[model samples]
Target: MAGAPIYSKADLARAETYKARDYPANVDPAIETLVREMMSGFADKWTVTILDTLWDSGTLRFSELARQVTGISQKMLTQTLRRMQRDGLVVRTLYPSVPPKVEYTLSPLGMTLGAAFCNVWIWALENHKAVDDARARFDEAE
Candidate 1:
């Protein structure tokens, strides 16, 4: 932990810009319900991983996607892709040829979602050490 990298103060300040300044007194129930549903969907680790991979790699074949997203089983990847496709997050292209060809890419909707979540990735990068130190302290106290 001693050699852990630390982000510059400017970087931290930039990250803070994304935080909500204030909330309206009145909230719409329908909007709150939609937000909750989306949060739960994005909460899946595999879903996030797949989104990041596709965002970086553009279009990728099924097997290649599996290779890029390490630790995801074929079954899990298939299920995650199915859910993503169903939710209009990814565009799956099927080519009719020998053995059949398929590729997955982020739809325009998915790209926007990826952009929205980019802030979360930046936050994690900046605060990972603080999180680790907190965990270490908590563990030692136990």
Candidate 2:
């Protein structure tokens, strides 16, 4: 850890200013905590996939979403949806019926998240070949 690069917030802010991009000099603790929590939640594959599916397909029932998100077990889907709902990333609706009727859609908060993730999709599309080649080289070396 001795040789590890040490960067201060000032340094980061300076770098951002050099690039003419906005950087918060004083980040609020609450906002930082929320960002960390949301990032941790979105780090998983299923959550990201579910977000993408919902973004593309709009409102969908549980079974429909399950089918769209291939390879996710019903239990896993249920758990993921529950987490998303709890996190305010998804909205769930239930209607009275003989059995039951339920649907899921992205909340306003979730739509903002989806928009933010669009930048990630753009980055992946731009750098996928470079990433793939790097992985292949690393595998060969290993």
Candidate 3:
């Protein structure tokens, strides 16, 4: 946490190659491609982490989510979940309690992307040693 950036040779190469691609403004990535990319990164960012946690746990109380993910403020998580709901990536259900109850889960469409996330999870579990080794090498380098 104290020092240099961590990236593998392949990571750096992909970064450069993606930067090198030149497509006209009219040439957009396919929707499926974009969706797959997002799904694959389901554990990499706060918003994605929120989604992936929900994916694994099924419907979860709103407070339960806030307690699990570190460093996410209540307002921020609420906003992210709202956006996912709007985008059809998540479903929100509210119950009329004496106070109120709210739960969140994946939509059927979201379930379709679960396999993509599962693959990323499996790869991360399998190759985290490589990631740790890269971090060590990076920290030791000039």
Candidate 4:
């Protein structure tokens, strides 16, 4: 850790200015913990897409599922499947075959969450026009 560039002049001055701004000294402990916990449960687009795909089909081969989802690479698809399996959102099974066979299906928890996602998506579709108008207005503002 020797010569690790400890606090260059610019960095030290930025820290001082941030401190001088006198931002809120404290946040509600409960709100802080709640926000952290809530945010930690968030999933990105690819993960949600995989989950949604599995929800649409009870079980599917890896390649077939990838076909159903647009613009997903084999590497990314495999990685996402493994992560979902590790998280207990998906169950991956391998079958012996001349070319090797595999299948993926949602676990109980995955199904539950998938159902929730479906509801949220349905609501979005139902309000698509409103949302589209909002987006249009937002872009115009920008």
For model 3, name the residue pairs that clash.
Answer: none
Q: Write the per-residue lDDT of candidate 4 for residues 4-120, one digit (tens) a residue.
A: 333458757867987899656798899899658533544556788888888878899988998998998999888878877877789999999979999999999889878878888
Q: For residues 1-142, could you state the per-residue lDDT of candidate 1 as single tens digits?
A: 7544455797578668756557777889998997898788888899999999999999999999999999999999999999999989999999999999999999999999999889888879977888897677767666
lDDT of each: 0.90, 0.90, 0.78, 0.79
Please list the residue runs of candidate 3 whose C-alpha ends up more than 4 Å from where it truly belongs after superposition: 1-44
Worst 10 residues of 1 by lDDT: 2-11
Error of 1 at 37 (Å): 1.7
Query: For candidate 4, what is the lDDT?
Result: 0.79
Candidate 3 lDDT by residue in tens digits, 1-142: 6465666798789779978889566645696687576655454487678767877788888899888777899988888888778768788999999679998898987776666768878979977887898778776774
Better of 1 and 3 by TM-score: 1
TM-score of each: 0.77, 0.78, 0.63, 0.64
Model 2 C-alpha lDDT per residue in residues 1-142, reported as the tens digit of each score = 4333445687578678878967688999999999899889888889999999999999999999999999999999999999999999999999899679899999999999999999999979966876686677667666
Of candidate 2, the 10-residue stretch with the lowest lDDT total is: 1-10
Q: How many angstroms is residue 58 displaced in model 1 relative to the true structure, after the best TM-score fit?
A: 0.8
lDDT of 2 at 46: 95
Instruction: Judging by TM-score against the true structure, name the best candidate.
Output: 2
Where does candidate 2 stray beyond 4 Å? 1-20
lDDT score at residue 42, model 1, on the 0-100 scale: 80
